[model samples]
Structures are given as C-alpha cells and as structure tokens.
Target: MSSTTNYILGVFDDEDEVLHAVSEVKSKGIKIDEVYTPFPIHGLDTAIGHERTRLPIAAFMFGTLGMICALSLISYTMVFDWPMIIGGKDFFALPNWIPVTFEGTVLFTAFGLVITFCISNNLFPGNNVEPLDLRITDDKFVMAINLDKNKLGQDEITKALKSSGAIEVNVK
Candidate 1:
C-alpha cells in the first residue's frame, strides 16, 4: 500500500520574507510543516515555534559513557590484569591515560551524534529522497504546510502566503 501526503508550498525569494511569512501564517492559525532555505537563517527556528534541540545533552551522555569505558579498560588492564610499571609511574596513572580517554570521548560523541541525526531524520541508505522544491537548495526559501494538519482551506492559505510576500504558492 502507498500513501500520499498533500502539502502547500509557499516559495519566497528572500529569507526575510519567509521569516515574516512564518509569523503571518501562524497568526492566521495555519500550522507550518517546515521551512527550507538555501542556507541557515538566524531566528528561523524560533519564528517557526520549534523548541531547542536536545542533541547537546545526547552528546554529553555519549562522551561520559566513552570516558567510563576508556577508564574501565585502562584500569582493568594496568591495575588488575597486567599491573604495568613503566617510567616509575603508578600502575594506574591519570596523566598517562589522558590521551586515550580524550580520544575515546571524542570518537563516541562523533559517532553517536551522526547515528542519532541520521536516524532522527530517516536518512537511512536506500530511503527515497523527496525535495519539495528544487530551488530550496539554491536561491529560494520555502514554507511547507501539510494540508492534513491545517484547518484552513487552500485558498485562505494561498491568500495568507501572498500577503506575506510569497512569490509563488504551489500545492503538491
């Protein structure tokens, strides 16, 4: 079985116009699905009412786990299993363990964040890619509104887009 989702796309030539349109559309009670731009626009996320991401928290957790694993391995090998005594240093010297610990923390955080981002965005291998508007990756700013999520009719939404400086409004 296949399912098709309908969307109303408001294409803007400028980032400022799209930013203003986000507020205008929301004021009229039309929920915006997402906004796409050629580059990042400051305050766009806030304007679109998206909450702050929790990726930093995830990174911290991953780093901590990595540090623990690194420390555990070093402690087990040097202090318990082998009991190494090199350069007159203690078997479990903190100074010597810094490099490995730092590397482990960085490695886990990098890999964890990449996996998290890919999974969150449904960007697995072989997943079909859908672009609402090709210009969104070049020069245009696009505001996408999922028709099923909005109570407003297409005509009303189109009017709202025009009043907010959209150059073209398309439905797909």
Candidate 2:
C-alpha cells in the first residue's frame, strides 16, 4: 500500500519562539511530527515529550564484553599459550592487564555507541535524505506537523502557528 502525508512546516526566527510554539501546539492538542534547530536547545526534548535515551546502557554492555575479551586474551597468551617470566611476574599478570583492558573498554564503548546510534536512527552511509529547508541548519528553527494526523483544519493550524510566533508557515 502507498502512503501519503501532508506536512506543515512552521518557521521560527528565534529558538525561544519555537520552544513556546511547541508548548502551545501541544496544549492545543496537536501532535508534532518533528522539530529542527540549528543548535541544541536546552529542555527542548522535555518540551516535546521525548523520553530519555538508553544508549548509555548499550555502551556499558559493550564495554563489559570488551573487558572480558581483554582478560581472556591476556590470560590465554601469557598463562597457558606461552608462559612468560618478565620481571619475575606471575603467569597471569593482573597488573599488566590493566592498560590493555582499559584501552579495550574505551575502544568498544566508542565504537559501539557510534554503530548503535546509526542503526537505531536508520542513518547510514548514502541514505536518501528528506527535503528540509537549509536555513533550519543555519539559524532558523523549524517544526513539522503532520496535517493528516491533526484533527484541526488548515486554517486553524495556521492561525495557531502564527499566534505561537511562527515567522513563516509552508505546506509540503
């Protein structure tokens, strides 16, 4: 089945205006599709009702696996595979494993976070991008509303956006 949607893009010159618009729109019982801002604004997520992210939990799990791998590698090579006698240290040298284990933990955490973010967000190399106003990436703040999903008519939606401080509103 083919899907179709109508979106209204509300452009705000100031971040504060966009923030206010979000609260006002939601209070008016309208669902927001998305919002784009040039720079990260404090408290915007909470205003939009977005929940906290769980990427840190993934990072911790990856780091734990890395630690296990590092420990296994060191133990196998130094203790069983080829027993080494360096500075009269024991075969399973716990002290020497610290540096490699720390490095492995950090490496895995960094790589795992990047991969998880890309996969979770459906972002990958050479993916087609949806059309967006270039000015939104520079200075303007843009909010998108799915017209099909909103029960309010077009006129009422436009009025609400303009009343909420939208400098421009475009239908797409």
Using all chains and alpha carbons, the TM-scores for the candidates as numbered come to 0.95, 0.95
Best by lDDT: 1
* Tens-place lDDT digits, model 2, residues 86-113: 9988898798889999999998899999
Q: What is the lDDT of residue 63 in candidate 2?
A: 99
For residue 160, model 2's alpha carbon misses the true position, in angstroms, by 0.6
lDDT (Cα, tens digit) per residue for candidate 1, span 1-172: 0138889899999888888889988999999999999999999999998999989999999999999999999999999999978999999798899999999999999999999999988889999886988888999999999988888899999999999999999988
Lowest-scoring 10 consecutive residues by lDDT in candidate 2?
1-10
Q: In candidate 1, which residue ranges exceed 4 Å CA deviation?
A: 1-3
